[model samples]
Target chain A: DVKVTQSSRYLVKRTGEKVFLECVQDMDHENMFWYRQDPGLGLRLIYFSYDVKMKEKGDIPEGYSVSREKKERFSLILESASTNQTSMYLCASSLIGGDAYEQYFGPGTRLTVT
Target chain B: TQLLEQSPQFLSIQEGENLTVYCNSSSVFSSLQWYRQEPGEGPVLLVTVVTGGEVKKLKRLTFQFGDARKDSSLHITAAQPGDTGLYLCAGGVLMNYGGSQGNLIFGKGTKLSVKP
Candidate 1:
């Protein structure tokens, strides 16, 4: 079975603070993604990485950045956290070819900004 | 932009009832996927339909993709409390830009509650 793990299951941060969410996948998938889910908004993509050092912005990438220094790890960074940034963050990975569309998601991290 | 619209945002029913959720879109999709997310957990892939007018069954759950590949449906038979969750439909599109190989457009989701 494929396993995707996040660095934190729940996190609390103050406004204007920097925040980092880490994700690691055991499967050697080539594509990794970051998404923030909200009520009535569904899962909106934040950023995605196709390979090491390659990053792409998704539909909603404002105030967020990503890092993919290695194939197994992907990180989401918030320059300065705001109350509006509080959300459930999910990380997913998939293989390159025919299976690329079938993403395996990690347990989400619920971030609270106060 | 590709968008998926899910109907009946919320549903509440007693056990042993039958229910169906619909996902509609105006744009064609290369493939469609269904996922179920329990409270406080991430969405899990339930099934994926690639061909048009395809039907796949998993236990008591049945999934169908429309002939035009622009819509899909999920039907649960004799629903149980264990089937309570948020159902999400996503459409896949091949991307030529954005360093990403492909992208998925997700629906707002249908939250279902089955009472025992």
Candidate 2:
């Protein structure tokens, strides 16, 4: 099975703290994404990278940033954590392009900012 | 600006019951996809419908895309406890994947609970 591995399944951070969430996929996919899932807001894209050293903001990229320094690894960074930023964070990867390729997702990292 | 809406945000039913979930959008898409997400896990791809008025089936699940390519539906027959999860629908537009997850737009999702 294609595995998308998240470094942490649960995390807790204090306000104003910098946090990092890591995601790694073994499928050798070229595309990686970061999204935050909330109660009614659903899954909102935070950032994504199609290739190494490439990144783009999604619908809700205001409070977040991303880094894709390697092909198999993607990271989501919270510059300054806040209470409102508490939610479930998901990482997903897919093939390059042409049609919306099916995405394989990591187990997700649930973060709680206090 | 492209948003997909899923109806019946929450549904609770008994096993062996049938249900239908709707995914609607104002803008036409090239293709649509359905996914099911379980607690603590990422969403799993179920089916993708491309052509307008197309229908695809996976066992007890049936998926249909509207002729206009702006909407889709998923019907489940004899839903089991394993069927309990959040169902999400996404649509693809003119080759713009914006940056993340290959540019997929997700619906808010329908949370279904099946009782034994």
Candidate 3:
């Protein structure tokens, strides 16, 4: 079965601290995405990478950044953790072709900033 | 900007009840997809409808795409407690942003609870 694993199920960070969340997919898909899920706003994309060392900002990429050093791993970084940034972070991967929109997602990391 | 609007943000029903969730948009999409996310888990793809006026069925669930390709709906028959989850509808659009080929516009999602 295809599997996407995240580095942490839950995390707590202090305000102004730098935080990192990791995601790894066994499918070796070419597309990776980072999103933050909030109660009323839904899942807002933070950043995405189509290939190694390639990254693109999404609609809500202000407080977040992403890195794809290898094909299997995608990392999400919080430059300065704030209380408003507390949310469930999701990572997803998909193929590179026409059906690349079909994504497989990881369990998600719930981060709390204080 | 493309936006998908989902109706009935929250639904609670008893086991064996029937329900329908609607997703509507003003912008046309190349495809529409349905996903179910259980608590603490990421969304899982349930179905994808590419053709206009297409209807697909999986077990007790049925998904339909509008003839205009701008809306979609998901219906469940005899829903069980296991069916409780957050249902999200996403529309696919071709994108050339930063060389990214495709992107998805997601609705806010409908949270469903089935009481057993």
Please state every model's RMSD to the true fold in angstroms.
1.4, 2.1, 1.4
Q: Against the true structure, what is model 1's DockQ?
A: 0.63
Across A47-114, the per-residue lDDT of candidate 3 in tens digits comes to 99888999999999998888899999999999999999999999998887567388888999999999
Identify the runs in model 3 with alpha carbons over 4 angstroms from their true place: B97-100
| Candidate 2 lDDT by residue in tens digits, A2-114 | 89999999999999999999999998999898999999999988988888998988888988888999999999999999999999999998887654667788999999999
Question: What TM-score, computed on C-alpha atoms, does each candidate reach?
Answer: 0.98, 0.94, 0.97
Error of 1 at A73 (Å): 0.4
DockQ score for candidate 2 = 0.59
> Model 2: per-residue lDDT, tens digit, B10-95?
99999999999999999887789999999988998898888999999999999999999999999999999999999999886544
lDDT tens per residue, model 1, B2-104? 8999998999999999999999999999899999999999999999999999999999999999999999999999999999999999998888854436778
**Candidate number with the higher TM-score (1 or 2):** 1
Q: Residue B66 deviation, candidate 2, in Å?
A: 1.1
The CA lDDT of each predicted structure is 0.94, 0.90, 0.92
Poorest 10 consecutive residues of model 3 chain A by lDDT? Answer: A94-103
For candidate 2, what is the TM-score? 0.94
Task: Give every collision pair in model 2.
Answer: B97-B103
Clashing pairs in 3: none
Evaluated on chain A only, model 1 obtains a TM-score of 0.98
Best by DockQ: 3
Best by TM-score: 1
Give candidate 1 regions above 4 Å deviation: B97-100
